[model samples]
Target: MIARFDYIAAVILFSIGLYALVVKPNLIKKLIGLNIIETSVYLFLIASGDVRLGIYTNQWAASNVIDNPQRAVQGLEPMINPIPSALVLTAIVVSVCVTAIALSVVVKLYQHYGTLDAREIASLKG
Candidate 1:
């Protein structure tokens, strides 16, 4: 049940991001969509790696959060995994670099054409 719910949410997020990416006409809007897509994938990664038990989310507040040993809740029996987290960290940096480069290109394009809309940019292109 938990798995199903998480997957459903992930799918929804990805779908919305995709829609935004495809349906938007402005370059900045498209960039925002790309960011949305990136964030959705990251969220999906973390959720997909969440520990579970018998259809239950086993995640709990750590002692660091509550600061009460007696009332502290144990972490998920199996800590989902760590590889995804590491990969996501790398992906985040890469995405940031990509976005920066893209923005630079877009700025140059705007300077040459003075428009941010994809349709307008295409018309201005020669």
Candidate 2:
């Protein structure tokens, strides 16, 4: 359970974000929730990609294991997985772009409707 603490925290964060996204009536609050959700996903991906190397895969090594040639030769030495990190980086860029676009739209909406409340905007729509 302790070993999987990060996963647990990520789940909790995701739940909080989901609740905020669903229940908030303010556009800005919803955007903040979306950002929180994205952050939880990032945390999950980073935690999942973590590889602990030592006597046991779950146990942390007391010393640096990257220099162990024998383990490397046997394909047992723990190495960093770049795929998740790369994906997270790409996702962050995409998230930023999406958030920027959404914020711009919100600004336009506020200018047109003179309000940022979703319910008000919906009711005012023709």
**Model 1 compared with the native: what TM-score?**
0.75
lDDT of each: 0.74, 0.87
List candidate 2 segments past 4 Å from native: 53-60, 65-76
**Model 1: lowest-lDDT 10 consecutive positions:** 57-66
Instruction: Evaluate candidate 2 by giving its C-alpha RMSD to the native, one decimal.
Output: 2.8
Window of ten residues with lowest summed lDDT in model 2: 55-64
- Per-residue lDDT tens digits of candidate 2, residues 16-102? 999889999999999999999999999999888887556364445764556786775676666667788999999999999999999
What CA RMSD would you report for each candidate?
Answer: 4.8, 2.8
Give each model a TM-score.
0.75, 0.85
Q: How many residue pairs clash in each candidate?
A: 0, 0
- For candidate 1, what's the RMSD? 4.8
